[model samples]
Target: PSDFSGFTVDGFKDEFEKLVETDSKSIVLDLSKTEFIDSSGIGAIVFLYKRIEKKNHKLMLLNVTGQPYKLMTLLRVDKTIPFVDSI
Candidate 1:
């Protein structure tokens, strides 16, 4: 969604959960369109990461830029979760 803030995090969480059922070895969350993200959004990403990790699946953040990128970098989350510029 456009706004990956607290308002959209619940939906993101629900949708992300469904992705776990897919057979794909890697799950990528494209943040190119996300203009805004709050703590709730970050929490959702962390939660998703843990879920994917437990399943031995990989989670990648794609096109993360602007404030979201800065925040994740600042928190050192980017160190744990891989960020990809392309597929």
Candidate 2:
């Protein structure tokens, strides 16, 4: 997903909710190609992370770099959700 901002967060939330409802054990968000992320996007991801945890599931961010990485670090999201360079 690219430009993970307010305009795109709702759709992402809905789709992610579906996956959670279907008992997804883990979710890997691939941010390699994502160029940007706003506060709304961060909130959405955090919300999803909490939801997954409620079901004993995990959420991982993959290939985060540039703006997204910096934002995540600034927000201390990396402290909560684990991230990796690849799947």
Candidate 3:
């Protein structure tokens, strides 16, 4: 688990990438704490998911409520990635 609050684009990307490096079966993105997200932020998440998938790991999005969820749905990113029920 990771919290991306107050993190910049590259910082979140870097941290996400680092988390993927660990030999874990699943990575749950806690988007609940994230108050803002730009295009780059979305890109970072997609990148992480792709990389994790390549390694046969799973990625799940959590607590994706409010504006972030709306933005993702509007961008059609929600269709590309699945969301979990609870955070």
Best by lDDT: 2
Clashes per candidate (backbone, < 3 Å): 0, 0, 0
lDDT of 3 by residue, 1-83 (tens): 23333356756566776888989988888787766676777888888889999999888888887767878889988786888
Better of 1 and 2 by lDDT: 2
Computed on alpha carbons, the lDDT of every model, listed in order, comes to: 0.87, 0.89, 0.77
Clash pairs of candidate 3? none
Clashing pairs in 1: none
Please write out the lDDT profile of model 2 over residues 1-87, one tens digit for every residue.
789999988777678778678666878988889999999999998998898899998999999999999999999999999998877
Structural similarity to truth (TM-score) of each candidate: 0.93, 0.92, 0.81
The Cα error of candidate 2 at residue 85, in Å, is: 1.2
Q: Rank the candidates by TM-score, best first.
A: 1, 2, 3
Judge candidate 2 against the unseen true structure and give its global Cα lDDT, from 0 to 1: 0.89
Off by over 4 Å in 2: none
Report how far residue 22 has shifted in candidate 3, in Å.
Answer: 1.3
Model 1 regions more than 4 Å off: none
Clashing residue pairs in candidate 2 (N, C-alpha, C atoms within 3 angstroms): none
Greater-TM-score candidate between 2 and 3: 2
Using TM-score as the measure, which candidate wins? 1
